[model samples]
Target: MNPYVIVSILVAYFGVLMVIAYFTSRNADTQTFFTANKKSPWYLVAFGMIGTSLSGVTFISVPGNVGNTQFAYFQFVLGNLVGYLVIATVLMPLYYRLNLVSIYTYLEQRFGFWSYKTGSFFFLLSRTIGAAFRLFLVAAVLQIGVFQQWGIPFSVNVLITIFLIWIYTFQGGIKTIVWTDTFQTFFLVSAVAISVYLISKELGLSLGQMVATVRESEYGQIFHWDPKSSKYFWKQFIAGAFIAIAMTGLDQDLMQKNLTCKNLQDAQKNMLSFCTVFVVVNLLFLTLGALLYLFAESRGIAIPGRTDYLYPTLALKSFGLLAAVFFLLGITASSYASADSALAALTTAFCIDFLNFDKRTEEDRKKIKFRVHVGFSVLLYLIILIFEALNDESVVTAVFTAAGYTYGPLLGLFAFGMLTRLPVRDRFVPLICVISPILCYIINKNSEAWLNGYRFGFEILILNGFLTFLGLLLLSKKRVAEPEVIPGE
Candidate 1:
């Protein structure tokens, strides 16, 4: 891969994105930016979600995990299916009934200002950090692999990369994102599919043979029923489900796209479609990993130390320049798709929940939205740099762990509202939500001793939620409402 060629492709690719942002920004007043006027086509929303659900993390991390992150990760995918059902049946109805622009407003309506702030705060803390970390993975590749070798400063590359995300997403929030994300998913999935075909071709294997090969690989195992560790079957299964629920169903970033759909059925349809594509897309990446490992075995190319790099390095080795071009485009698409949406969601949540800008007109709110968008971009820039400075473990692993901690409040809020009948003290709800994860962290830190040598699985979300639920339980008063319980039993 020529350095100049890679840079040129990246430049051209982002130029397309700028056009998307510019045109979308044309009529992107507050409502158009935030809500897409609630007129976006469901099919397009569904299509765009494919990219949001799977980011550059999915592009790089999913396949890499096929070999390294254990074979049992498919348990998470199964959990996602369950979580989507929960979202469709439970969360969507509530959102639709209330007609929420920022979903956190439901917290205020249900539990009061405290709960609303709690939900929004958790979203900001977790999402901002997670998005920054995600963008960092792509930045690492572009900076060290591309820019550093080309004598461009790493900071400058990071700035340019993040600036591009803000440029496109700062306008038309959910509305612009729907179309651009659709465009991005096209190249992202197509590039992966083409690379898969080429890889299969190189090995002289048909699609069936490719599938067969992965099935035979060590990465094929999808379940481990142990309750004691991260691989425990039921534990992982539930944890995986909540991860999907929190990260996708509950998180504003993913749901913003889903919310753009015209109705709950459409959003549910979008979720099902996204999940269907997700399973296959992951299989595609896993199969690619199997092929790459096989290729390495055949050609004696030493695999990289980090499995995450397997795809990029393998693509570099196995494909021609044109394929490489598509590979970078895929990377750009995946990274930007998730990152841009996150920024938009963060800004939307801030404007709606914290600032109450929904009551204001577009002319009065435009500057505020732009300022918040830029502020988030800078916040993410700082976080990504910190991750770089630390230079610790894999960024993807950190992301999964962060999801457990950050999304705990979402799980807690929903569980408290749905599973219990206690009337929450609205003013104290935020404190309860805030205390839950930190308590979880402390318990998680000392669990080995606290649980009498019973350790927790890496999906600490279960514990986080239970802790939050318990806190809410303690804070909430059992109030007898007019018996309106529906006869589900």
Candidate 2:
């Protein structure tokens, strides 16, 4: 609970990451930064991805979300399982065969320049906002938990957090991130486990008893069949599958790490392993959420207005110093693990997709990349500030809604490229991508009146993609001969 102790822990944490970056980055070049020279171990990449996929949002929100949604989120988790399988069997092979550094390059080769840029821009827009929102959550937590007591401004906390990420990632990029994420995943999971154990102890329950309690609690209810509810099983499951494909298979931040594996087979293995572990980790978070509510009920404590605040408030005020220690460590690990990787992916995308980093001399390339990297860092800093000034919704909700809009176009573009052989009117590809999200926004806003009271959820991504797919079809021409099919079917 002491501010000095929290600062000390943070300093020590960044020191370890910096040391890791120093050694990994020795003699690193652009290839090493972007692809880790394609030598990352499958096992490490798999483990590390657990951190990147979850982030601070999942660390806090999923469990916190249990109070309102109950176990309904489990439906989405099941959907993610199917989505991962699709990525492993389909997308990974295509990416490896193409030998892509930035996955959007597939668009340029398959469609044309405009489609390629459109895809890359969607990624840039989606990831920039997603990563900034995540960093914002961490910065806000640190500002309240540690800095306010020391009379530091929120802006300073945001700057320091982003600066730490940049310091370690600026050198080795994916090479450093692949390893650091693995280390952070350990602390993040450990924090949840410890919090679970301490809460059980406070309630005087053994591990078995704790499990029993959570299983029987009202918050543990998982299945939902109501058509009107957003968390209904089929809706969540189907949406989760498409979300995984769109966000992970199609996302540069995640795929960048996947591409670092030695080969296609290794990448598939990593994805499968990551999928299995991801399910287990989420179960732990849900159980912790149920137990938190139970603990509060037994002690007669009032639940916070925002469920996101539940974990932090209890850890700092209700649990003792030890719980606070792990809470800080866990949140920092989760937030930085995702944010740092995203920063690297954003830099790689801009340099390759826009600036053509490969065309320049080695000396010139490095200078351009360094400046671009700094530029993205500044962009992320500004976005987080904007979010702080205006955000009123739960961050988890905001992130998925934003993804539905930004990542939707990417989902449509990739789906059209892979699933069809027709070539679109090249110049119109960007317009189609742009219009798809706007149409989606309008439809979503008026769903109740326009669609007979049908409320859209994350599945809005699927609808957006379909609209884009239809738009592409209108602009497309069938190949003269048998069309070239995507490699992995």
Candidate 3:
């Protein structure tokens, strides 16, 4: 509960990260920063990615979501596994074959310059906000847990948080993250596992008793068979699958790490292994969630105003000092893992896709890359301030809502390009992509009135992608003389 103790933990954590940055970032260049010179081991990449994929959002939001949604999230977790398979089999092979630095470059090769820019722009927008959203949640928790007690402003907390991430990441980029994230993931998973143990102990349950207790608890319901609920099994399953593909396979922030591996087989192995770890990790979070609620009921504590507040509330207030230690470490590790990688990826996307990093002289390239990296850290800081001012709902929901719109166009663009051979009118590509999300938004906003009270859930992402696919279909021209696809050069 002491702010000084929390501050001590943070100082030590960043000290270790800076040391890693020092060693790994030495003599690193644009190639090293962007793809770690394609020298990262497959297993290390796999291990580190588990942290990036979970983020601070999962660290807090998923556990809290259990209060309202129950184990229904596990359905979405199941969908993520399906999505990971799609990425491994369908997407990674294409990225490897083309030797892409920015995955969006594939759009340029397939469609035209405008499509390429559109895809990159969407990634920049989606990841910028998504990363900020993740950071915002952690910043808020830290603010509550530490800074607010010390009279520090929320903006200062955000600035400091992003600043620390920028410090370690600005030099080494993905090269640094491949190792740093592995270190962070260890603490992240340990925090969750320990939190579960502590909470169960508070309730006087052993590991076996904890399992039986959660299985019988009201919060333990994992499946929602009701067709009308947003958490419906099939709906969440399908949405989760597509979200994994759109947000991961199609996302540069994630695939950039995968791209750092030595070859296609190594990358595929990373994806598969990461997928297995991801499923297990999320299951652990859900189990922790059930325990948090049961612990709350046992202690006669009121659930916090926001479900997002539930885990932190229990960890900081209900659980002992040791739980608080894990809470701070876990949240900090998870948040840094994702945010640091995002800062690197945004710089990579801008430099490669927008700034022509490949053509610039090495010296000029370094200058521009450094500036872009700083610019994004500032950009994220500003967005988190905005979100702090405006966000009222569960952040996890806000994240997915934003994703359904932003990532949907990406999904459609890639699907149309990969699945269909028809060439699009390259000039109209940007317009179609723009119109798809707007149309999806209007439909989603008015769905109940327009669609007879049928609500749109994460499945809305599927419709958003379908609309873009249809828009692209209308823009499709006659098949060109079989444009040469990448031959896995």
Candidate 4:
């Protein structure tokens, strides 16, 4: 709990990452930065993705959220399982067949210039915000755990956070992330597993007793059937599927790692393996949540109003030195694992999709990539400061809510291109994408009042995508004679 100790842990953690970056990034060029030269081991990618997918939001918020939402989030997790299947079976094949460096290039090949740009633009928006939200969690915790004790302002804390990420990632990029993430995932998983054990030990409960206590507790319920409620089982399940598809399958940040695998089969194996581990890890977090609450109640600790604060407060103040240390390491690992990849993906997308990296000389490409990477890092720092100023609700909720609006167009664009042979008026694509989310916002705000008290949750993403799809359909003409085909396919 000492500020000096926290600083020591952080310095040591980043030191490990920098060492990994050094070895993995040596002799690294553009291909290595963008695709790890397509040589990453599938198993390592699968294992590392667990940390990237969960991030700090899951590390803290999911457990704390168990008090209010119970196991209801499991419905969303079930949907995520389905979504990952779609990504593996449907999207990954398409990406591999086309041999894309940036998946958004599919939009260009399938549609036109505007559609490709539109898709990439949405990705930039969605990932920038999503990554910022993830980093904000770690920044806030660092502020409370270390900087606040030193009277350091939150803005300065955020600057320090972003700088650390930029330093390790700027050179090796995705090549560095694949290795570092695997190392960090170990700490992240261990922290949660050990924290749960410590809590049970403190309460004088055996493993079986701990399981029984969580099951019988009021926070253990996992399904809601009310159609009008946001947490309805079907709504959450269906929304979870689409959220995974849109956020992971369509977004470059996640899919970039998948692309780094050698071939389609290897990528598929990575996804399926990641899906199985993803579910088990989430269940562990939920279990930890229930235990945190029970531990608090028995000890007469007042629960924090913002559930996000609950995990950090208890870990630092009451859970002993060991728990606090792992808590800090777990959050740092989860946050950086996701953020570093996001930075690489953003740079990759801009270079390939926007700047025509393929057409440029290698030397010119490197220079541009460096500037773009730095630009995004600074952009993320600003966004986190802004989020710190405005965020009021749970971060996990805010992340998905923002994704619902931002990623909706990507879902629609990909869905429209794959499912139909018709071409759209090229220039109008961006307009359709823009108009879709605005209409979705209006519909969501009035859903309960106008739609017979039907409240919207993550399903808003589905609606947003559908609206964009319909808007594109309205602008389409007669179908072409034949669909375009790749040479090998």
Measured against the true structure, the TM-scores of the candidates, in listed sequence, are 0.94, 0.98, 0.98, 0.98
The list of candidate 2 runs beyond 4 A from truth reads: 480-485
Local distance difference test scores for all models: 0.78, 0.90, 0.91, 0.93
User: Candidate 3: misplaced stretches above 4 Å?
Assistant: 481-483, 486-489
lDDT string, candidate 3, 1-489, tens digits = 888999999999999999999999999988899999999999999999989999999999999999889899999999999999989988898998888999999999888899999999999999999999999978988999999999999999999998899989988889999999999999999999999989888889999999998889888998998787788899999999999999999999999999999999999999998888898899899999999888888878998888888998779877889999999999999999999999999999999999888998989989999899999999999999999889898989999999999999999999988877788898898888888889988998898899777678898889989998999899799876255654332
Looking at model 1, residue 294 earns an lDDT score of: 76
> Candidate 1 residues 283-371, lDDT tens each?
67666667777777777888777777878887754677767777888888888888988999999899888887967876779989989
Cα distance off (Å), candidate 3, residue 83? 1.0
RMSD of each: 2.4, 1.3, 1.3, 1.2
- Which stretch of 10 consecutive residues in model 1 shows the poorest summed lDDT? 480-489
The segments of candidate 1 whose C-alpha lies over 4 angstroms from its true place after superposition are: 448-455, 480-489
Query: Candidates ranked by TM-score, best first?
Result: 4, 3, 2, 1
lDDT of 2: 0.90
Clashing pairs in 4: none
Worst 10 residues of 4 by lDDT: 480-489
